[model samples]
Target: MAYKPLAHIPTHLISGILGVGKSSALLALIQQQPPEEVWAVLINEFAPAGMDALLLQDQVPQDAKVTFAEVAGGCACCLANLPFKVALNRLLRQTRPDRVLIEATGLSHTRELKHLLTGPEYAQVLDLQSVMTLVDARQLTQYAQHPLWIGQVQAADCLVANKTDVYQAEDYQNLQAWQMRAGLADKPCYLVSQGRVHLQWLMQPAVQEANKAPTPLFSPIISASSSSAYQAASITSTVRLTLSREQLAASWQTWYQQQQKTWGTHIRVKARLSNMQACYHLQAVGAEYQLDVLPLEKSSPLSSMQRIEVIAVAAKEDIQNALTLWAQELGILDEA
Candidate 1:
């Protein structure tokens, strides 16, 4: 048997609204990848302070060869084309990685970026892995009325309707309506919480036959499971907990069930475990579950860190309360 050669660097373009958890999702992905694999992350933040770039750098594996690029001052999709090209060129020239993750600012144009990556010049360097859009469930009503929103939805290779943890029963009804409005009923858009995504789905290739057909609301290539659950959009809260090697797996199962119940429609729970030998991970996007445990360096600091970074995607009050509750369950860190 023979297989088509995979791209040298599987780059993902993550685009979404300003507060829709794009940065958080990028952080989670960085946490999951092995350090020795060599990955380059390019973040183009719209804000002037470069805060998102700083946060992403902090999450990188210390020993991993990582290059952080910041295109600040304006929307990368509009005013930063040269900067975007420079960043890509620099990453390819300096630290050649197996994959690159581009976290696009809310106002950036997905189609433009796709054009740039798929253009003849870039084809020799970067592989366009996928264009993923993050949608706000609570804003579905508004999104349905906006032309730009429809454009964004149409351009995505994968659509993640995030913050499902806060969506009401009526919201899904509205979501179905919204889905119909966008003419994306056939596209494969998963209602994921806390940016929880299946690495397997990310790694898999797009279905060539379906890719040639009319627009689809979801990817036909996605593997289905009896346990997978899909939800409407809503708020979401995430808490990362560090556990002992002996206590880790069992503790996660208990927490996951409690999370699905307590946050119910208001949460999406994801976990990453880094012990001495490897990093074991699990993500429940609605009812779907995926597990992967990859080997790590013996002397890596991952084991000692034993840290989980939880993010709440709804309101400030909800975030504070969720953080408080999690701190009690997972123990808060003392001030340095």
Candidate 2:
């Protein structure tokens, strides 16, 4: 059956695990939007720096046609999903865009978000075209990474295997098994790289994309009460750190690992810090983190002051507090 395009404004929700290329795909999709129509992108992140907002703003021209607002502090569904609605409604009311696109926090439960979108309150306002999930082919190569990605599979209206430029034989085999589990291979699943999804393809509403009924999106509180489960948080500190970029990178990784050993996996963390070498970007998922030198070259010279933003799942405040204490222990606590 041919998918029908709605006459109303289309709102797209792009979801994926952290570092899986949702923003990259979204940037590609937004660039294709009509130049004359006003398009609003409401981005949520767990960091105050709001890296996605910076990345998206950098790609899109600074014009009236494209407007952006950011929701930071934590994932959208946390805190009773209030902050998400407040920020989203504010963006929508203020922008009244011809189109609305929401890039949810990487750790957000897409099912929870979808429930909100289709619920009576928003159904009238949001012409939800689809929920697109982007996956990294490299991550699919691992057997253990499967559980981490299942939520994305269940909630997406389209499944895009991105970064195929790095695919190996094992990755393809793993993907086959994954797709079979998802029942999305014969649906609208696709393989692409560098976030090149066409905007038109995602807007198709009538296409039957998945073989199974929609999977449960949340487990009553996103497993909030489970002692074994993870909870998400944002940790920000502005302080003086004298370490070099390489040193900072190493330290961040070590800290993440030590915490993971004590608590659980650190889902993702993005930090911008100014050190003697330069102000650099630190990106981490699990325990691995890297310092990108290119952003440094374009960045301003380092000052004694560095503002750090961290987003991770450490389960309730007990772990979150410990992570905060760890950041302070690094002697980077900034009072300002």
Q: Judging by TM-score against the true structure, name the best candidate.
A: 2
Taking all chains together, each candidate's TM-score versus the true structure is: 0.58, 0.72
Q: Candidate 1, residues 235-299: lDDT per residue as tens digits?
A: 11233235554465665556656656655433444444454455555444344444455555432
Task: Report the poorest 10 consecutive residues by lDDT, candidate 1.
Answer: 226-235
TM-score of 1: 0.58
- Regions more than 4 Å wrong, model 2: 1-7, 31-34, 46-51, 54-65, 72-81, 137-151, 194-196, 206-228, 237-244, 260-266, 275-279, 293-331
lDDT (tens digit, per residue) of candidate 2 on 8-73:
557888888777778778889887888667788889875545676654553455554877788876
Clash count, candidate 2: 1
Q: Please tell me which predicted candidate would have the highest lDDT against the true structure.
A: 2
What is every candidate's alpha-carbon RMSD to the true fold? 11.5, 6.4
The global Cα lDDT (0 to 1) of model 2 is: 0.66
